[model samples]
Target: MEHMDSSMDIQHLLMMGMDLYRWTFHDNWSEVVEQYKNNAAIHTMPINNKEDTALHVAANNNNAVAVKQLVDEIKRTTSAVESLKKKNGKGDTALHCAASIGSLQMCMCIIEADPHQGHVLIEERNKDGETPLFLAAAKGHKKVFFYLKDCCVGESIGLCRRTSDGQTVLHCTLYRDHFELAFEIIHKYKEGIVGFVDEKGISPLHILADKPSAFESSSNFRWYNWLAYQCIYVKPLRITSHSKSQQTALRGSTADTENPASNYISEHENVVPKNYWTSYDIFMAFTRFIIWPVWEAFGLEVIKTSRKKKEKHVWCGQILDGLWKHKDVAYVGGRVKAYVMPKPGRETDGPKGDAKQSADGGSQKVTADQDKLQGDAKQSAGVGNQKVTAD
Candidate 1:
């Protein structure tokens, strides 16, 4: 090989200096810290095509030593720490990128370099509206989650901040099956769950119920099941007075006209109303609590039998009788009557007497007057009783 020229030697030295800077970032070498202090040229070099300064690359890679060196170099050259205001293509400061990756050490370095960078923590959102904490929670990075949590505590920044879809990090944790993290977040921020609806009007319970596959797939399904069960059973701590008033109105309108007007007018007599909580709401809430545990403990055979189309009426009839027996407990002292409409194969049997049944049944005196009024509409017109009583 021909002898190397001084010009080529100088170019080689420059390339070596640039490579040293890149290697310092890649390996987090401490020696480069000393060299960076002496040579200002190495301080300003970019690594690769990302236009990342030595500081940006080291922070992105979580190289704490290399980051310290670059920070020191900038402070030495510019006589001010503000020269560290480098940003990449996405407009992320080095702190933003490091926090996105859950780099705790680099985060501390940047924060210590300038506590003002904490503002950037909340400001930096990826294309998905994910803050640093959001990404950390999504990844189940508990340390990072708490780090961001402490950063936001008492800082006028709500940790329960919503995503574009209106999902708080807690919602995401639940959806992603990060159950432990979800519980921690909920415990820390109890109100986080209340009134949190997704893009759909679905509440958390609705979301959980609609995704049976997720329920089945979770490795810790028992824990999730128990949590869901508890959530369902824990009644709303504060019931609105409006709901109470609506219940009272329904009770007043539906009370039996035969009862003494004084009895109907009594405040205690009409305390609990019917139809306040619809059957569907009670059924869904009760089923959510009971179905999984009951199914798992005892196989679905009993439930399946009760659920069969042919047996539905029989089961419902039994359930109605059961409710009638415990009406005081079941209905909370409300008026309780059981009326089982005749099934296709069944006949009325002249309204057999049952005290808990409707008054018509308990009366048992099927007078002609009552019969005429009960007559089918088709025959009643011929009877010329234009009273046109309903069957």
Candidate 2:
């Protein structure tokens, strides 16, 4: 319970076990026994200026070997779970330190050492309401983030969680230009997260829309931009293809590398929609999702008398309205549908080889049958047109 200053005495005490802390960072485990035997009390004693235990110091240093030994040595006397859970001055356990440092090995060492309570430890939040996975994301540590993600398999989907500031790991990725990681969050978390507006009232789409410059710097900008726009702008539509061949064509040419989607839009059969989506849907999405927030915050303003008048342009909505009113968008013939991209969310919803092959095959068969029914309806319409011409 005592506070240890950063002074030499504390440094010297930390030197004992914390030397093992440093040594483990270099991955040297030799003579660890003699070191622990010589000054067991001192090393186990409160060490850092913040009074971080030896384990905390080791984790802060990203020393997996030291963390493992300390956990092992301590497991004999006290519970490894409790020791790993101990917090320092900043309310961070060794796991928190490891996560912030983005060291997967160090984190795994601590977690594996205390398997009984590791899940609790991994999910534990610091003062910031950020779990270890969140810290890894904040640090741009994808490998560490991935390992921790696997641990949250069935139950804690909150692994893709937000911080106290209402920033998810997806936001953290974009802030650091980890483009792929941003998509990973969208694909992994799906609808449960995609609709969530953070404390700032900004959805993930808002994040991408704000950072257009990010597209310029991304190495896989084509893929990244396409994916971002899909999650941010298109996913909400829930659009579907009209025919089997259309779906197959889209599945093959999703990327520009093979065949651009624009080619299909201009040349191929119009991708028919499954449901009716009206102008209001577009208006609501633009106003509520995009335009209103900006309009409310920084849109056109005029000063009248003693007060300033803020006029809502509802600009995003206005743009959609203008486009529809202009007759530039043609609804003639079969309605064209955009090709669906296979992203993380799509992984479980993809091909015969993936996600429950038999079930997916059945769904495909159902789709084929629906396509046939539509084809028969079109033939009947053709016959009706011919009879009217004869009359």
Candidate 3:
């Protein structure tokens, strides 16, 4: 001690502090922490490459005990809790890092350190504009999602949101086939769905209606299907009105070059039969193609019975007849007016049981068998210990 140079001694203590910070993040909190407690130079050491204190490293690594120790030291020495908003090299605070990792407890601790930090919790975007909520949602951390929901009370839930394709969180949720989380968000924020289009002009329903095969492949296909069905059925409310001049000028104008009126009646009248089917029609086409083919292949009798029963209903038959009479006026004319033809002795159970049983039982068995085969193949391939990866 008598011979040690002042600068060398200071450097030695700083180096020891850096090592302690590293060990704390490595989850060896007890050993090097005492050195941190005794050395004044420890608090000044930087481990985040941005000259941040040990607290920054502890928070980044989600080491709660280390954070507490650092906080206590700061309080005892400086007589005040240090600001939790200290930014690292990438402009991320401890809360941001905890959020990126979906560490709910760590996020709570940072917020508890300063309640005002809750706003910053989701508001903080990484270098890529991804908020903590976005990360949690994309990574499928249900707990983190709930935690953010809780913290967002009295604050805007729309904070720090970014879509994978640069849309809002609501828009991103719409494109997601798994609707459990998205439904929760929409229920809380009802107006969130309006005008939330993705890169395409396609709304949430349009997105959900697309790629029926994608839903079929998901583990939660039934839920996705139900949600997609809901999306398809719930037509958005129309609010705008066209000018009287615009409406009258287009009345009865069957000319191919005339602008179609915005009203549903005029639009339907003007649409060329071949072009009448929108994206919804196309989606339904693929959906039926994938789902109906399987049903027809295995349950031809059930399909026949369902079709016959549906046709036998007098109301349905009459509607078809009326549509056929007005074929020239309706878009898609003859093709759209075709009735469900009845087959002799092929009528049963409102066609309900047949469709339900086939869709439910057959699909369940097929999925179970496929899952079993995949598990066996994976085991044989020796990747059985690996985590199942999602697309």
Candidate 4:
């Protein structure tokens, strides 16, 4: 049996594949129906050129009817499902071929006909180690990509197989300028896809940073739009009527007893507006959060004035880079070593697992910060008590 299967030649498969492909031009698949009746070989033979079956050819040609017929024929035999999975020379099944062509109907026909069970082929990878979802994304086929994503019922969209270089479909979508598709991937797999970094320690955030144009193409920063008060997008709103509200949320706003807007704004629409960043942002994001506190944390006051720093209109990325660069400077006698980001989502891990060991060393700094927080909390609690004590 093995010898017989191996003996099937290129000429035989081509003849079979060609016959099936010819039927796709018909309005009702009449030629295919006739061919299926008169010649079963055309339906059963594997095209040896790319190792594709007739279904592969039909899918590439975008003939949903032909794809379904081929799928149905395969379903007639239990072992034929194995044939459906057979890859061409490029390691693509019929579903992969359909995805490459952005044919949603053809893909539906192929997966729906799966004799093996629910959506096994949806996760199948091609020669590049990409699932059908990745192919659709790379080809800029948003509709087809979502269809496959929806088929992922009870499981992930099978983004498990990255390219040989270790990039996921998210990487491919962003690289291809498939912003709509990329957003869909992020929406469907936020935690799993967004934090995914390739071998180079690059996350989707890194990709988005490189391609800010992607924002115009399909902006999803709305989730953070409300968070703009963090000092990136809220600058514009501040020059207007929202400052008191901003001040109230971050600091305490009780001083403005006459200004109800401040209290109302803080009570409702939380977090505020700004340009990407400003002097206030620089302090809030970096200096106030780290620098001023660092001296107290490590009992090293000289560290602040030890060096004259260049004053510049630092943007968000620059501020982040600076902080990550100097994050460990608080360590006792720590010379500035070259900076390395923890694996995406592992920023707290420090330089590899070695940072994991010193997890105990920061207890003092944490306690100090915590104690300060406790003091502030008590103050806030006391204020609350005073306000209610009158009642």
Best by TM-score: 4
Candidate 4: tens digits of C-alpha lDDT, residues 190-268: 4444444454544444454454322222222233332321233212112122232232242222232223333222221
Q: What does candidate 3 score on TM? A: 0.44
- In order of listing, the candidates' clash counts read 0, 2, 0, 8
- Per-candidate TM-score against the hidden true structure: 0.42, 0.47, 0.44, 0.48
Report the poorest 10 consecutive residues by lDDT, candidate 1. Answer: 235-244
Model 2: lDDT to the true structure: 0.48
Evaluate all candidate structures by whole-model CA lDDT and list the values in order.
0.44, 0.48, 0.44, 0.49
Which segments of model 3 are wrong by more than 4 Å? 1-17, 31-45, 48-82, 116-118, 153-155, 163-165, 171-178, 198-207, 214-391
Best by lDDT: 4
Candidate 2 per-residue C-alpha lDDT over 318-352 given as tens digits, one digit per residue, 9 for 90 to 100: 21222223121111112211111122223333221
Q: Which regions of candidate 1 fall more than 4 Å away from where they truly are?
A: 1-46, 71-85, 116-120, 153-166, 197-207, 213-391
Q: List the candidates ranked by TM-score, beginning with the highest.
A: 4, 2, 3, 1
Local error of candidate 3 at residue 239 (angstroms): 29
lDDT score, residue 95, model 1? Answer: 61
Answer with 2 or 3, whichever has the higher TM-score.
2
Per-residue C-alpha lDDT of model 1 across residues 1-391, encoded as one tens digit per residue: 3456877866865785677766755574666666667766555455556656667777777656567666766666653234454555555556656666666555555544545555445445544555666666776655456555665535312334344564556556656665445545544443323223434333333333333333212112234333333233212111111121222233223343122222212122234465544564688678758875687577644344323321222222222233234223222111322222221123222113111233233323212132222222113112111222222
262 Cα displacement, candidate 3 (Å): 51
- Predicted structure 4, TM vs. truth: 0.48
lDDT agreement of model 4 with the native = 0.49
